[model samples]
Target: MKPKFITISDSIIKKIKSGELIPGDKIPSENELIKNYKISNTTARKTLLEIESKGWVRRIKGKGTFVLNRTATHQLVRTLGSIDSTRKGFNESLKAEGLTPKNIILEKTILNEGVSAAIVGRHVIIEGPVLKVHQLRYADDELMKDETRYISLTLCPKIDALSTEISYFKAYEQQYNLKINDIRQTLSADILEANSNKNHFGTTSNIAIFVLDSAVFADDGKVIEIEYSYYRGDKYKFAISAHPEYGHKSDD
Candidate 1:
C-alpha cells in the first residue's frame, strides 16, 4: 500500500507528463490541494519536500514552489580547462526538464604574487608573478560555489582592471585575446572553515565538500590559470568517463 501524499504527487507528475502542468508553473497551493484531494496539510507539505529533494521543483522562501523543466540547461560537458562544468547527476535532472544554464559571476579581485606547482620537471619556466581573481558562480541565481584563480600576468597584464559585470572567461577572450585549451585536475574532500576557503566564503561551519584544484592551459600549451573551487557536497556531484587502452585485457 502507498501513502496518500505519494498518490497526490503521482497525480501531479502525471499532469506534468500530460502537459496539464507546465514547466515553471507554480504548484497548487496547500490549501487548494487539501480542498481538492481531501488530504491533510502535513501530507501536502511532505509531498512537496519529497518532490524538491528529487529535483522536480524549487521551493523559494516567501515564494511558491515551481515545476522544473530540465533539458539542455543541465547538460554539462566533460572537457579540459572547462570552468563551466557542473556536478554529477544535476545535469541529468536539468535535462529531464527544459532549461538552459546561466552562470553569473559574483566577484573578482587581484593579488600581489603567484603560487608554485608540485610537479617536478615543470617548475623552472612555470614560475611567474600572477594575478588572482575570485568569483562566485550560480545557475539561474542559485549559489553554486566560489572559485579563486591565479592567472599568469604575462598573458593578461591588466587582469586587475577587469569589470565585475563580466565573467573571467569572457574578459580573457574579449579583452586579452586568450582562449583556454587543456587542464589538469585533482580533487579532495574537506570541511568548511578549515583554511583559505573559510576566509573567502565567510561561514561559521558546515558539512563537508569537494575541493577542486585545476591548472588551466591555453591553446598554445601555456599554463594560464590555476583555480581552486569548493562545492557543497549535498548539492553537487562529479561525473567520469572511462576508455580502455589498446590491447588491454579486462581484469574481471
Candidate 2:
C-alpha cells in the first residue's frame, strides 16, 4: 500500500505542475492539509518535507511554505580543472536530483586575447598566445552551461600537443609536472544563445546566471589557466557562506 505522506506529496506535486499552484504561491498549511486530506499531522508534515527536498518549494519559518521560484534544475559546486574534471564535480552536485553531467567540446584554438584585470598579476596566456578551448556542458543531456578556457602554452609548452583522451589538468601534470595550488572564482548572471553546432539549450533560450570566471594557480602560485563560463540563468542559483566583517582595533 502507498504511504499516506507519499500520496499527499504526489498530490502537491500534481498541483504544482498543473498551474493551480504557482511559484511563491503558498499551499495549504500542515493543519489545513491534515483536516482536508483526512491524514495525520505527521503525514502532512512529511509531505511538506518531501517537496522541500525536491527543491520544488521553500519553508519560510515565520511566513509559510511556498512554491519555489525556479526555472530549471541547476546546482553547481565550483571546482578548478579541465572540462572533464568539472563535469565530474557537476555530476556529484546534481546526483541527488538524478542528474548527470555531460559535455561536448565546441572549439580549441591558439590565440592571444580575453584576459581580465582580476587575473593581472597572474600570467595571462593572451599576452603572447594561448590554447583557447570551448565546450558546452549539459546535465543529463539538458544544456546547462558554456565554458571558455585560456591556458598559457608558454609556461606549459607541449600543452597543445596533449592527447584529447586525457583531461587538461591531468595532461598538464603529465606534460609539465605541475600541480594546482589554489583557485579564485566569481559568479554572475547572463543569457545564452544557440551557437555553432550547439542547440541543446532548448528554444526557450532565456538568460542564464553563470559562475562567470575562475583562475587556477600552479603550485608555485603562477596562474596557469583562466576560465569564463555561462550558465542557464533559469536553472542556476548561488550559495555563499557569510561572515561578519572585523573592524580595526585601537593600538594598545
Tens digits of per-residue lDDT, candidate 2, 1-252, equal 888888888899899888666554577889998899998888899989988898788776765777754545444333332232332344333442345557688788887653543542343333546788787777777777777878887767767676433456655666678766555556655545545234346655444456567776676666677887777766654433222121111110
Write the residue-wise lDDT of candidate 1 on 116-191 in tens digits: 5632224412346677666665455454566677777888887767553345555566678876554466667887
| Segments of candidate 2 deviating more than 4 angstroms | 1-100, 112-126, 163-166, 173-175, 192-200, 240-252
Q: If scored against the real structure, what TM-score would every candidate get?
A: 0.48, 0.50
* RMSD (Cα, Å) of model 2: 11.9
Clash number for candidate 2? 3
Q: Output the lDDT of residue 11, model 1.
A: 80
Q: Which regions of candidate 1 are displaced past 4 Å? A: 1-109, 119-128, 138-142, 193-205, 241-252
The C-alpha local distance difference test score for the whole of candidate 1 amounts to 0.58
Worst 10 residues of 1 by lDDT: 243-252
Q: lDDT of all the models against the reference? A: 0.58, 0.62
The candidate scoring highest on TM-score is 2
Report, for all candidates in order, the number of backbone clashes. Answer: 12, 3
